[model samples]
Target: MKLLLDENLSWRMVNKLGVVFPEVVHVTSLNISQPASDISIWDFAKKNGYTIVSKDDDFEKIVLLRKAPPKLLFLKTYNLNTEKLVNLIIANNIKIKEFINSDENDIFEIFGE
Candidate 1:
């Protein structure tokens, strides 16, 4: 599945994890205006077949309000360094993929180690 990293996430993470998530892209790289809003990102993801990877609770509310086409991966990892976050994702890659491929769920959260 394609991943659309939200504005809260660094675009560098895309380059760092490109091998694992080849289809990933970041909001900063999008053609849309810089500092795009959550709603605009959501709309973009929905239109582009991306599963959003974000830490925003606003997205959680959005998912609750309107289910998926753009799935949500909520990162609850608090205050982690970039390396730790990357490692955490690498470790949980399988579970993340499974969650994405699941038919019944639209949201998946990744908590820090």
Candidate 2:
């Protein structure tokens, strides 16, 4: 599945994670305005078939309120360096795939182990 990384995440992650997630992209790479609104990002992802990867709770709130077209991968950990964060996501790749493929769920929460 395609993944649209949220602003809270580093744009550098696109290349790093691209090996496993070929369609991964950071929000900055898109044509949208810098500091895009959560709703705008959500709309973009919905239209483009991207599952949002974010550390922000705002996306979760949006999904709860509006339901999902663009799914969510919510990072519950904090204070992790880029490498650590990348590793966390990579290690959980299978779970991510499962979440993306599941028809019943829209949000997947990832906690640092």
Residue-pair clashes per candidate, as listed?
0, 0
Model 1 superposed RMSD (Cα): 1.0
Error of 2 at 88 (Å): 0.6
Q: List the residue pairs that clash in candidate 1.
A: none
Question: 1-113, model 2: which lDDT tens digit per residue?
Answer: 79999999998888889988999999988999888999889999999999999999999999999998889999998878788889999999999999999988989999984
TM-score of each: 0.95, 0.97
On TM-score, the leading prediction is 2
* Each prediction's RMSD to truth: 1.0, 0.9
- Candidates' C-alpha lDDT: 0.87, 0.93
In candidate 2 the C-alpha lDDT for residue 39 amounts to: 89
Error of 2 at 46 (Å): 0.3
